[model samples]
Target: MRKNVGFHSVRSFSDRRWLLPFLASLLVSFTLFMATIFGLFSSQNVGDSLSLDIVSFTTLDDFENDSIGTDRKKLLDQPAIMQEEAPRIAYLITGTKGDSQRMRRTLQAIYHPRNQYILHLDLEAPPRERIDLTMYVKGDPLFSQVENVRVIAKANLVTYKGPTMIACTLHAISILLKESLRWDWFINLSASDYPLMTQDDILHGLSSLPRNLNFIEHSPISGWKLTQRARPIIVDPGLYLSKKFEVFTTTERRELPTSFKLYTGSAWVMLTRSFLEYCIWGWENLPRILLMYYANFISSPEGYFHTVICNSNEFKNTSISHDLHYISWGYPPKQHPLYLSTKDFNRMVKSGMPFARKFAKGDPVLDKIDRELLGRANGQFTPGGWCNQTSSDEMAEQCSSRGDDSKFLPGPGAERLQQLMKKLMSQEFRNGSCSSLQYDQTKRDWITPKKPA
Candidate 1:
């Protein structure tokens, strides 16, 4: 009788264990059902509040108007966005034979301790000139102290009309990328280029911009020049030759590329570090493919970056459609732009462009610019807020010593640049970015064929 009673007790406990778990599961299900019903009802209430009928008490137009005005006022009251530190620029100044002095002058005019500079005297320059350039860059006290200046040791045989020029530019960019990662933008300039503003003004103006913008004046390659540029098969001997040589054309003509459209633009460019990284690193294959395609293309410098940037979905919208340099061309245009002189100074200034190109080496207009616009005395670096010499009496020795590089005292130049930037960022400018048909039309008009008279 005792054994049977113990067995019955164990069976009863086991049954009760199952009952508890079942009841707990039932409770959880009930809780979830209740929560779902509550959520549904709350959503219905929100929907009702948003309905058109609710606007009877407060007219929809009136509410919208009030909200829009309030939002605008709030946006206006918000603090302006600014960078925590002054932006740094990386400059690649290229030159050929007989450009040593001019390159040095341009370097000093644009030099700032906060920026990095790389000088490339191409293989066309004699060994003595290259040595002299290297010595000058190394001998400068400020450059030695700051260690921001570098010279390309292995000079490239660059052909301006061939892919070699683009290769040289890329080589310099690679060096800059490896040397310092702090610079925000990379600006490419020839020895013929000169700055119209001080580094302080540039930094001040650029501080307000998004860092990813690329300034490259670009349009599609079409019309009269299309057959000339795209159909020819040319070989650039600079790629394999130890000495410079002109590009030679083959007898065979090929069809225009069906894989990708061709684009052309000014060779001069100011590109962002991120976009350059994308080009150099090339996690995507577009940059590499276009590079190979342009290897045989004439004047690759004019088209390589333009084609790459416009074709890239990632970087197309980031293009600003301006080269940021003031250049003058003839009515019908020519292979080379007309050399700028004193006569063009007023127009150059009025244009509000920061840099101008193809200035004759040591032109009097450069002196005028240095005197009036840059305030840089003979053989002195451009004066900036970073220099302690403020008095006119010390003009001769200004920029010899350093002050607070972090501070900037921008003048009229900065205001002009700001105005230009506002215009570039306007709705009109935004609408014109990477327009396929519009670019083709512009190219057609630019190189319109004359009637056979």
Candidate 2:
């Protein structure tokens, strides 16, 4: 009798367990149904307030209008003064191990109160070095006061000639976009790169131009380069591994993509913010699709942004077909350009390029550039209109104090850059079959094809 009673009790508990869940679910359904009848679930009631603010749930005009709104705000705020002054530029200065000092020098050379600077030292740099750099930036009174400089605290492991290089660049762009909205252009430079002109000169030269122009060097991929660069499959260990390693090539070769064309150019570029936004936000699918395609391509940095800009319809016409860099290459150019020295200084200045690259650390030519081109005193910020000019006795001390950032003191460097821009925008340069104008090493400037007589 006792055993039978226990069995009955167990059956009753199991039956009641199912009943509780069933009742709970039924109660939830009833509550939801009551809410629905009250119009709580209706689209009109739920989204009416949101709809009033958002022009449409569909179409991208709203997104474009928001960007235009910012522009309108700028126009309303400054009217004519802001339009005449130089546009704010955002710089991504990247370096690796043993490059902290060089990065500092480059940073000082290009420093301006009106501009934004972000420094990135890849994982290859030691933590102590990174910390020291952060301290240097923070310890400076001018940088702390104006607050335009930032360092990437969490650095990425960038593998040379790999997709990681592209990844690091895109990461920096996103951070800059989030931190500031006033910048008009994004320029990428490595520690090895140094500015030939002051920030004032580059700013003044670019002030009159259309803000949308992208100074990227690009040429269509064809023949040998296509076969060698595009067909290979590569895996950058830096993507998965914590430590740095060389990218390995796979035996499997992929066919050329038929959807979008491939373009190649110099790794460095001076891109407009709007184009970079499209690349980063991916309002359309092309940027993402190409990003995946380039992940395995050799030297992705050289081709990723170039391919994206060329393939994009909205941005294609805006490309200026020049990197605005004075890069010297040997005859039948090797994989890397010759390490620049005093010999290249004359040509670098004549090229009218704003910057040059692959300079050796502690090179004597750098000092000469400082003395002649930048007018930057050793370990001092490049003097600009932003530098306070109180007394000649406190010349170095004057730069320590900030002045009217909007004020620009244009110099001879601006004139040189203007001439280069004129040639780049000329009808003959724009109408060429290929957008890339080759460098005439002998002539020491761009070879703009002569107009047919």
Candidate 3:
């Protein structure tokens, strides 16, 4: 039996309960009373733990309506004066050559003074292009003043559709973690991706969540994927050669890992800081073990993090198994999802996903998103409550001046995102974790075993 913590019980004033539970409640009350008489609040203070991050299983509306945790209760009871203590996201936006301008535009659209951004143009981009990106970041008045936006000076040779993608991601992650290390989560995006919600909506929605939960969409390999993906052995030349080359497959095949089950998913992810630390610099051996194993795995980006997370018993239960990106797979499937277009706008907005990917550059569809979906006035940052500049000058208005970074004015995005999270986090979805399946030659699909409750 699990030992119940005595500190959690609330005093029952009007309820009739069993003697055991009643006595437990009385005991908890007495304990707190005694603690108050003395100085025993230290138990709750783990490390600079003054902030009440206990709104999990609760929403911002709930925070307003009810008397919640002691500190949150007190805060809610106060007048609606916003305090500046919101969490910040560290973004690693990577792209290859010919994507510098798109990356720049994406960066500006998502830019906030509070968040850290690391833009990378991989080795496929010529030296001039990389220099141009760095110059762009350095020259921008807002970027220069905030000092949170950075362009990768030393670019990695990222192999298209290879483990190099994950490597480049981790490289940026390591630098950020080592340099500032204050971010709550590390979100990886490519230049092709764009945010569907304002930063205010994104941050406010996440503020109520448990900080440790990782949002990675993943599933077990079955049928076609198991054979077509796992059995193949291919080496990425980006790992050794200066210039990127195609992956070469060996005639040999390998067996699935006995120690850990393999998982696969979308490359886009919003990973928790604690999990990132484990994957990058933890004392544990699992991260390194999986890294070496995936060196020869085709499309390692999909499987690398998935395998490490699902295989570790500790993290499996914690996986929400959703990459949180709005993407549409073509019927019968294709190499990449159908590039999001104007036709997908209504569905995209209703999906409640914070980000969507694979848009054709400067597509008129993007303009529609900017105007209607994101509320970003033409080529401007998403207009949030944080924006305070006068709306006269197009370039120097609204986003030029700022308010408290912590304040939030979440629009429809928050509501949509909350519903999406509810589905991913439901008991049924979580219990149906990454499974082991075998291909049925006749079925021409994965034949999965009956799952146990």
Candidate 4:
């Protein structure tokens, strides 16, 4: 009986000790479970608050929600929202020293209340000229009222032959994308470039076409160009220097890249906003890689975008293979095209191209273009449907009214441009796209147009 009592007491004590430890474990688990639940709830609440803030911000800044107008406040806002309205163009007009007047003239010639314009006077221009350009944009009653025009206060030093030109263009594109403007196409022009037709004509012609089409002239790099452009190394001093200088070529040459095919063409282009977004954001790796590679290539501007679009599977088919500028190159083409004059006017008119380049400053041909093609008078905005059209005060109040810009009154210019578009979109031109080019792996050269069969 004594042995049984002792054993029973010992067993009872051991059971009590085990029970205490089990209870302590349960309490610790319960405390941790409660903490996790509280943390999840707190996190969800914070996330909900942030989501609401983002939603509210996007709704307020959306341009598609409001009617189109010269709303300066909304236009100046950041993080632009694209609108699904009538097609609008965004223009980047670039110039250097002694080009303020020419830039202004080009601006006025291509001005439309519906479109967006950003003028870039490069770093070479004096501060006084930049200020004068800004004042001209601000002081004009029509420009002030429309508010689509902007002068880039900060300028970039551009070497025409180097990547700096491409940088300036991309910088302008980035600014346009940041603004609250809705545009379908992005067109880059220079102080020497002038419109052959009215903005009404251009807008009208483009309205009928697909917005995805990119008017960039491109061809595979081969022959002498491959040796000169693709193999040579050049340095653009404008990249780091404060002053303008010519791009210098290095003594050594690089072997042509085997990973990607090289392409080169006219530097002037009318690119789609979507394609420009791809180039700028680089969600895909191709554009970024090509940009780095082209950094050292000679005449990077002429080849950079061309190579990018041709290599991109998503954007290659969208290329139209035309630059849309009636540029006349000399026999064997001396570095630049000849300055167009009155002698070229007949050819320019018949060419049906919307724009032409390398025109002499204050040329009589510009006066003829203004009077005959654009119906624009001296120091006046190009007359369009947006202009005030009262017979009583025709000349004075010609462009005073900020009328509806979406409604374009296109004339013969539209017909000519339409014909040109038709020709460009024909089967022959469509068949000559980037995909049609055949690459010979053995010879490491692009075969000429595959001989049709």
TM-score versus the correct structure, for each prediction: 0.77, 0.81, 0.75, 0.80
RMSD of 4: 10.5
Q: Candidate 1 — which pairs collide?
A: none
Against the true structure, whose TM-score is highest?
2
Query: Which ranking of candidates, highest TM-score first?
Result: 2, 4, 1, 3
Tell me the tens digit of each residue's lDDT in model 4 across 1-453: 999999999998877877788899999999999998887688678785755565556665454452321243234222233334668999999999999999999988898888999999999999999999999889888788878898989899988688988888899889888875788899999999999999989998887676767889989998989888888899999999999889899999998888889999899999998889889987557889998998878888888989998997666766778999999897988888999999999999999999998898899999999988988888777888877687633732577677878778898999999999888876577676684433233442323454646
As a whole number from 0 to 100, the lDDT of residue 21 in candidate 4 is: 84
Off by over 4 Å in 4: 1-84, 392-396, 435-453
Best by lDDT: 2
- Write down the RMSD of all candidates, one decimal each: 12.3, 8.5, 18.1, 10.5
Q: Give all candidates' CA lDDT scores.
A: 0.82, 0.84, 0.76, 0.83
lDDT of 1 at 286: 83
Model 2 scores worst on lDDT over the 10 consecutive residues at 73-82
Candidate 2 residue-wise lDDT, 1-453, digit = tens: 999999999998877878888999999999989987766446566675654455444535554556544554454233122255569999999999999999999999999988889999999999999999999999999999999999999999999879998999999899988875579999999999999998889998888776767888888888888788889999999899889999999999889888888899888899988889889988778899999988888999989999998887666766877888888788998899888999999999988999998899999999999889887889998888888886644655588899988887877789899899878877566664244343332443334466669
Question: Which TM-score value belongs to model 3?
Answer: 0.75
